[model samples]
Target: MLKLTDMTLHYGHSQILNGISMEARQGEVTCVMGTNGVGKTSLMKAISGTHPRSGGKLELNGEQLGVLPAHRMAWKGVAYVPQGREIFPLLTVRENLETGFSCLPVSEHFVPDEVFDLFPVLKQMQNRRGGDLSGGQQQQLAIARALITKPNLLLLDEPTEGIQPNIIQQIGEVIRHLRTTSRMAIVLVEQYFDFAYDLADRLVVLRRGEVMIKGTRDNLTRDQVLQAVSV
Candidate 1:
């Protein structure tokens, strides 16, 4: 459902992504894996419009989305759960979820019951401030907040980073459910090899701002991919 052709990006004259081309299909997890400084998060920023591409094309559902900003992208069904979780420290859990209402119509302002079902802990701490939650809870809140936007294209950058093992497993299940149940086109940028490999239907390995390996999981083994990303 998402197509990127020759996608390029730069920061202050230094090119981060060069001639990158990839596609993410509905009901599949397209995991982007790489070593540090390989432009994984930079690619996510470009797709989510947090940073504009230097040159290239971004198309969603056959419609070319030419250099739109984050808010515009969100309206077009792109939800980004960035690397740091970025939840509001002072806001209550419910309030943070409600923050997504800015992208929705006024009639759809209420929080959906399924959100609480996905993270039952969030239901119990509806009034607790975001900063009070544990790291894992915060991560779940971040994903739930993104889901509140009802995105067709979900860009998740390193959801497993710094998360506890059990929570990481929960997050994996959530991602699996999202792809299978809703057919969302998920583009995940992950450094955790096992986590990415298990969930990825297709994998794209990037090195120095370019694709080094791109193929289905059945065609690539963990050792092969691990060797490529190992610096």
Candidate 2:
């Protein structure tokens, strides 16, 4: 559902992504893996329009897109759960979820029960301030808020980072359910090897801003990916 062709990005001449090309399909998880400083988050920013790409083409569904800003991208059905959760510390859980309404029509302003179903804890803590929640709870809140956008392409940058193991397993189950039930394309940037590999339908490994290996899980072995991303 999403395609990037020879995409490149930079921060005032210090290039981050170099001619990176990949595709993410509906009902599948495309996991982007790499070690630190390998431009994994930069790639997420470029696709989500948090940072504009310097060159290359971005296509959503089947339409070609230009260098649009984040809100515009959200309006086009791109929901980003950026690293660090980035929730409003002072806002209540419900309010933070409601913030997603900025991209939707007034007629569709109400939060759906399915969101609460996906993260049951969110329903219980709807009235609590975001800053009052635990790390795992906050991460659940972040993912839930992104789901509020009803995106066609979901970009999750390191959802497991800093999360406890049980919550990480919960998050994985949520991702699995999404892939099975919806046609949304999920592009996950993860450093947690086993979690990422187990969930990935396809893998794209990056090293120093370029794609080192890209293929289906069946075609690539665990050790092959491990070796590629390690170096």
Candidate 3:
């Protein structure tokens, strides 16, 4: 459903992504795993249009998408749950979710009932300020807000980064359910090996912005995925 062909990016004279090429298919999770400074998040920024690529082809369902700003990409069905879970501190939980309404028409402005179904805690705290929530709750809110956009392509960067174990399990189940029930393509940038491996139908290993290993779970051994990010 999404493809990045021969993508390369640079910040100033320093190159980050090197001829990166990958794809994410509907009802499947395509995971990007790597050591730090390997441009995993940078690749995401390029695809999500948070940052433009210097060279390469990016296509969404065969429609060519030139490098545009993040909001433009959002309008085109690319929903990004960035690394830091950047929810507005002062905004109430409902307000934060409402922010996604900008990308929708007036008729679809309200948050979907499914969002509350996915996150019951969020529904309970609709009137509470965002800053009052715990990190795990905040993460759930972030993902819920992204889902509010009804994206065709979901770009999740470290959804389990600092989450508690129980919450991590809940998030995992949510990811799995999304893949099973929806026709959306997911590009997950994750360092937690087990978490990524569990949901990943396919994996792409990045080293210094280049793909070192790319394979389906059955084709790649678990030790190798662990070793690739052990640096």
Candidate 4:
């Protein structure tokens, strides 16, 4: 549902992404695997409109990005769960989720039940401050907040980072469930090969901001993916 063709991005004078090309299909997870500092996050930033692309094209369901800012992208069915799970430390969970309402009409400002079903802890901690939650809970809160927008393209960056093993398993299950139950396309950036391999229908590996390897699960093995991602 999302496609990036020869995409490139720059930070001031330093170019971070180099002709990166990949695609994420509806009802599937396209995991971007790479070592640290390989521009995986930069690629995501380019797609999500947080950092605009310097060159190439970004199209969602054949619709090219046309001068859309980050808020505008969120309004156009793109929801991003950033690497650090940037939840508002001071806001209550409910209030934090309400922030997503900025992009929605008044009639669609409420959180969906599916978010509670996906992470019950978020519902339970509705009135608690986001900063008080543990790392795993914070991750769940971040994902929950993103879902409040009802997006079609979900961009998740390093979801398993710093999360507990059990929470990681839960997150993986949630990702798989979303792929099967919802039509939303997912772009996952994960350094955890085992987790990404298990859930990824397609894998895209990056090195120095370039596509090093990419294919479907039926064509690539865990070892091959692992080797490609190794620094």
Q: Which stretches of candidate 3 lie over 4 Å from their true place?
A: none
Q: TM per model?
A: 0.98, 0.99, 0.98, 0.97
Task: Write one digit per residue (lDDT tens) for candidate 2, span 1-231.
Answer: 999999999999799999999999999999999999999999999999999999999999999999999999999999999999999989999999999999899999999998999899999999999999999999999999999989999999999989999999999999999999997999999999999999999999999999999999999999999999889
Task: Compare candidates 1 and 4 on lDDT and give the better one.
Answer: 1
lDDT for model 1, on a 0 to 1 scale? 0.94
Candidate 3 matches the true fold with a TM-score of 0.98
Q: Least lDDT summed over 10 consecutive residues: which range in candidate 4? A: 61-70
By summed lDDT, the worst window of 10 consecutive residues in model 1 runs over 222-231
Local accuracy by lDDT, each model: 0.94, 0.97, 0.93, 0.91
In terms of TM-score, which candidate is strongest? Answer: 2
* Local accuracy of candidate 1 as per-residue lDDT tens digits, 49-168: 999999999999889989999999999999999999999989999999999999999999988998988899999999999999999999999999999998899999999889999999
By lDDT, is 1 or 3 better? 1
Best by lDDT: 2
RMSD, every candidate, angstroms: 0.9, 0.6, 0.9, 1.0
Candidate 1 vs 4: which has more TM-score: 1
Q: What's the true lDDT of residue 64 in model 3?
A: 96
